[model samples]
Target: MELKGIHHVSALTANAADNYSFYTEVLGMRLVKKTVNQDDTSVYHLFYADEIGNPGTDLTFFEIPRAGTTYPGVSSISATSLRVKDDNALQYWKQRFIEYKVDHDDIITVGGRKIVSFRDPEGQRLKLVSDETNNGVKGGTPWKKGPVPVENAIIGLGPSHLTVNDPDPTIKVLTEVLSFKEIDRYPSLVQGQQDVRVFSTGEGGTGAEVHLETRPDLPRERPGRGSVHHVAFRVDNEEELQYWKERLQSARLPNSGLVERYYFKSLYFREPNGILFELATDGPGFTTDEDPEHLGESLALPPYFEQDRERIEARLKPLDI
Candidate 1:
């Protein structure tokens, strides 16, 4: 029943190429894995993160051409934060954001740590906070290439904060089934004093925060063209997956049917808060597509796409990865 922090976060983007450019060239995240959505082979499922593409470091995207508009409401989520080495790293990120011509908010203090916020090409909110100050940067991602040096690049996920209308079910799921403890709570500056509660895994050292802000004056989120698709948490293997399956059933929570995703098996569910949550197994990971040493060098696909590799490669717009 011990959950190992967030596995990865997935967002929907209008263009895979644009998302690729920003995450790689601008933000300096490594292209850890590249493949098509297994369900819809034409669409791309891209993942970007720190070195080795560790679980929490991941921020994923799905590019579907026809998916319609974005609605910002109670159900929609906001900025997902990444952890950096320290205040100096935060300054490094600020200048990088400026150099790339990406819009960013001035540095703001949250929970006694400094964080800088910015948007990806598709307007998904993201932030980089000082890792040491947050006391969550026990890990590091080595940079393969970019303006930001390895030491300054993001360490990994700080927290995937959710803005939920009802915190009870989400809290229950986190504490009861997922084995997350109520670490602490505080007032947040990002959303004007939204109650912030943090939870960390006994195993991963990565943490997730839940922010509840009463925006009675504002509208709830409508998910469409550009918004989070789902957020996944890591489970080590089939044993862990089954543990969660029984746990969810016991709690009377609904689950998306289990799916074999090549690299991992996954279970999906929506929290009462309306955010899509997934539990994905840890491995037969990127190596499934290419050897570990040569991963992300070309258009990699799951075994199912191996037969169409030639056509799939021709269809995707060429990039200088």
Candidate 2:
């Protein structure tokens, strides 16, 4: 079975409150889920997306109050992209970033599309890509009531950038194992390096691409605040997730088989370069527990964690969104 585009990219953040402010207030994405990390109940796990949290639109963060700075290097998810409606929307965002004092670079074209790179307060490497020419997997609707104008608001996630020491092994996993097709390549921003490769899966476009940057000279990344923890690709449903688990096993790729994430089922594994990858189902989404209109308004816990809600709430610092 073919995989859909990206499901979500989860990153690290030391301060949930500030992370909440930047993503919601500045980026104008909706905070679709306010919850705790299932693996670590002591910290906050926040999700930001378009109006309602659609599978491919979510950008999540796991709060680690004492997390240190990320040492950028190879074997990392170097950059995460958010899609805007068009090139004109990129212009609007450039001026908005200026007005809000958000750190950003001038708009530039890459891989035949315009993009503007930027960083959050915690130095999360991010970019806004124009979807004017996109015709594959569709983007989501922007939040109508968010701070940014609806026309120029961030819609959904685009391609994720992966930096690796040896591209061959990662490329093998992406192509032979996961069935991503190499579609294009562009000169690396770093001088004298090989051109960055672009790979895409089902319904290829901005949303379905993985840009591979080979950095043989760099060391392995030391992940902390602002570092992407993992990038997940979307599967159609639980049955498809099971098929993927079997496929990973058949390929002798070690994985976390069929994890019940509550909102979605998942299977986690690392490509040969040690970059974490997850295959996640698209259904039983964020609306499973929270009402659509009032999502992210209160602390939400899965059924299993409901019993410990009081203890979990006691440990988390109040986040004002």
Candidate 3:
């Protein structure tokens, strides 16, 4: 499998407008698409990415007001990490966060790298790491119209850190099933034999890592607001996608058969630790429906939900930002 990196990371949001404001104004990301949740047409499914909505640059959200508080424990995507150009860009964001009065932690060094931990308005955990080691952009674009200048802008999604109950089976999924290379391992945060293992694909840059931080003592996490819904990895095209589906089938791990999300083709499956993983195709991108310059300006619906547009438009509130 030619896994490029993170295709996108989708999490839940209680308020749509606040989510939009935080990602667009505070984080300075582009709202590439404003579409409804295909499974349920009433709620809005928003996408925030770099300039042209590149594959690895996407961080999306599902506005679900009725969802309860997020469960902070094992079997969850505990944090979504992003990478910037260099330390100067990292410092620029640190100062920018302070100026905007955003909630964030003091800088911390982990594994000889600087990272700034923060949370969105909805309490979703996020981290920004300097891309000093990895020179590649991982396929991204700078949003000139966004709040931050191009240099200081977030390059793309770095990694989706998975908090698993047991690391062994999850490791098997990555190393055996997904063909991820076990690059390194480190001591665990908790005082025990448990530890964090880093795996990667496609040359293993910043965004390409899949960190399995085993915290066996914690309780199992349930789906709700502020929790990651799913983490998607990118594949080149249809053939690679089919190969992965066959791998999953041969492994006897259950999967969602070829789902069309309008912008991309997706396959959903849960690993041994119960974290949902998606294999998404890279082609037939966001430009299929709307023009590049005018994405996310108005509502866009899939063909099946076109007739329900009137009702869908009525239920979802307009984004103030």
Candidate 4:
């Protein structure tokens, strides 16, 4: 059973309203789901994605109001990328970042693709990669109603970046256990470090690759606001998700088995270096409970939480999006 590409990447934010504004207004992504964290109902769990919140398009955030700043190092999902149409789209975004006064770097090539690296107000590391030369795992459609024009809008997720002290353990899990094939390598942006290795799954394109960097000199990351919580890969359905759970168990890896995310099923496990990875299903998506036209317009809770909606809503701080 081969897994699909990325399903979603969840990060942390101290302020849901500000996060909402930045992702929707500045990044031009649609706020597809405004919901509470299932584990803790007091805070917000916001999802931003391309039009209709398709699988592989989601970039989610968990609100941790008092979270501290992230001290970047090894064993972290150091950077998460969003895909754009082409090289021209990168130029459009570069200019737009200047217009918005957003923190960004000039367009640069990474692993044979053009990309513009940037950060959110909370210092969450992000990159916009051009899909001009991509041939595998097609990206999602942009939100037409968002601020940016369709041609220049952000599409879906690209290769996720992982930093580790030693790459062998992580590489072993990715290759032997997860079935990701090492496809390419590129010079590390950091001087004197080993070259970054590229790994791909499923269709093997921009959307399906993982960029692994080894940084033995750095310490473990202190996760807080702006740090990625976990990165999820796509599973086709519940059957496949169950298979993955069994596979994880058989491999003697500790995991959260068969998590009912309501919108989708999931199984979460951490690799050898402590980076959280989740295998998630593709169907029963954001549109499950809310109308596509009005997604994120109101607070959404799973069926189990419906009875407690009043109390849940009372505990949540109103997001002024």
Candidate 5:
């Protein structure tokens, strides 16, 4: 089965209120869904994305208070890369970051394209790469009314980089199992000799590309705030989702079983590098729980948690976004 692109990149956060403000207020992404994690209702599961919460636009967070910082190493999604229009768009964000004092670096070229590295308030690694070098700019519309205007708003995800000790096994799973093509290999932008391998989809866009940062010297990373919990690959619908489940299990990869995420159907598993990966469908999306016009207006809970809404609400802190 062919995969479209990335669905969403989920990470951890220590405080929901701060995570909400950083993504919504600083990053200018819309709060598409304000919900709790189904299994762990005590912690908030917040989602940020373009208006209407398109599949590729999702960048979600699980608020685990004081989750601490991560130590750089293997088996970790080191950076979640996002795309902007061009150098002009990169400059737009640079000025915004300058004005707000957001921790970031000046524009740096990567694989012949410009990218500005930045971090969220909770220390989650992120970078903004220009669309100048991709096959074509994504067609998805940005939320024009957001804090950042349509001209400067983030287009969608770019290459969510994964750092690992060995790239062979993970590359095997991606090429043979997931069917992602090894398009090109480039010099490591972040390390010497350890060249980064680029794998892209037959269909390229939001979740189109992934960069394997092969660093054998670095130790394994510990789970904590600022670290990506999982990177989801897009499936057009349930049929695609099921096909992948069988494919992964057939390859002898242990999976999380089928999980009902309310808005989407998901099957999760870890790749060779110990980085968690997910297969997520595009339908029954954010609008399933709330109207398009008023998504993320209030705290939303799954059916199982509906009975204990009051207690859950009281336990979770209100988002200041």
Candidate 6:
């Protein structure tokens, strides 16, 4: 049971093009892979991350047009954070937000990191925190154009914040199953009047804020457009993955049968608190399709979808890639 921390975060959106621009242009994430959602032939499953599309680096999206309106509540505060170089970069992003006309707010501390909160066009909450401690950039994928330089660009996803109706169950999963140690607790000054508990790996220093915030007064959320569909945690390989699967079953937590995505194998389930979670493998990743040099250009499909590629391609409307 060493469940590597969060793998990637996936969000549902009404428009792929807008979501793509917001992630790559506004938030400065590289679009690593572009493919249609397997279940929904017409919608795109866009993966944005550092250069090589590392797990934990990605913030993916599924474009669903007819998906309904949703509100931020206990189960759905999809605050995906990015780690920048230092306080200087934090200040730079604050100014950059003003220059780009993106709304932003002042400092908030989580797990000792100073974070500035902002929103995408779809109102998904995102933050940028300054971390000067670690410089490990193995396979780092950065946004091509932004005010922040590639070195200072968001190295990867910092955390995926889940606001739960009842934090106990989810908290148990993080601490017991996922090996995330609770680092701190704080009162949120934001609109939700929430209580935030942060969990992290390492000694809990540096850019650590894989947080869980709770709002006892808020209603629970359901899946739809502009919602975080799930948050994934990484495992080293199939051995660690099966260990987690058995642990989840022994704990009586419901889990998806291991599903192969070709690039990696994934298992999905919901914590008792209602937020969806997935355990994803870390190797044999995105380079399976095109060259590592050109990952997101053109359509890339799993072996299962190769023959049906034409039908899937036909259903999806072209976006300027």
Count residue pairs with overlapping backbones in model 5.
1
Tens-digit lDDT string for candidate 6 (66-122): 878667777764677777767777877887788888878887665556889897776
lDDT by residue (tens digit), candidate 1, 45-113: 888877667666778888877777776666655657777777888888888888888889988787667
- Over 41-157, each residue of candidate 2 has an lDDT whose tens digit, in order, gives 999999999999988899999999999999999999999999999999999999989999999999999999999999999999999999999998999989999999999999999
Worst 10 residues of 2 by lDDT: 238-247
- Report lDDT per candidate: 0.73, 0.94, 0.85, 0.94, 0.84, 0.75
Model 6 residue 145 lDDT score: 55
Where's the lowest-lDDT run of ten residues in candidate 5? 132-141
Q: State candidate 3's TM-score.
A: 0.96
Q: Write the per-residue lDDT of candidate 5 for residues 1-321, one digit (tens) a residue.
A: 688888899999988887787788888888889999887888889988888888788889998897988876888899998777777899999999998889999898877789999987777889998887667326345777788988878877778898889999999999999998887777986546577888887476435888898888888998798889999988888887888999998999999877888899999999987989998998889888788888898888878778999999898877754
Clashing pairs in 5: 6-207
Q: Give the number of the best model, judged by lDDT.
A: 2
Kindly give the stretch of ten consecutive residues in candidate 6 with the minimal lDDT sum. 201-210
| Of 3 and 6, the candidate ranking higher by lDDT | 3
Q: What lDDT is reached at residue 157 by model 5?
A: 79
Off by over 4 Å in 5: 136-139
Candidate 3, residue 212: the lDDT equals 84
Model 5: lDDT of residue 102: 95
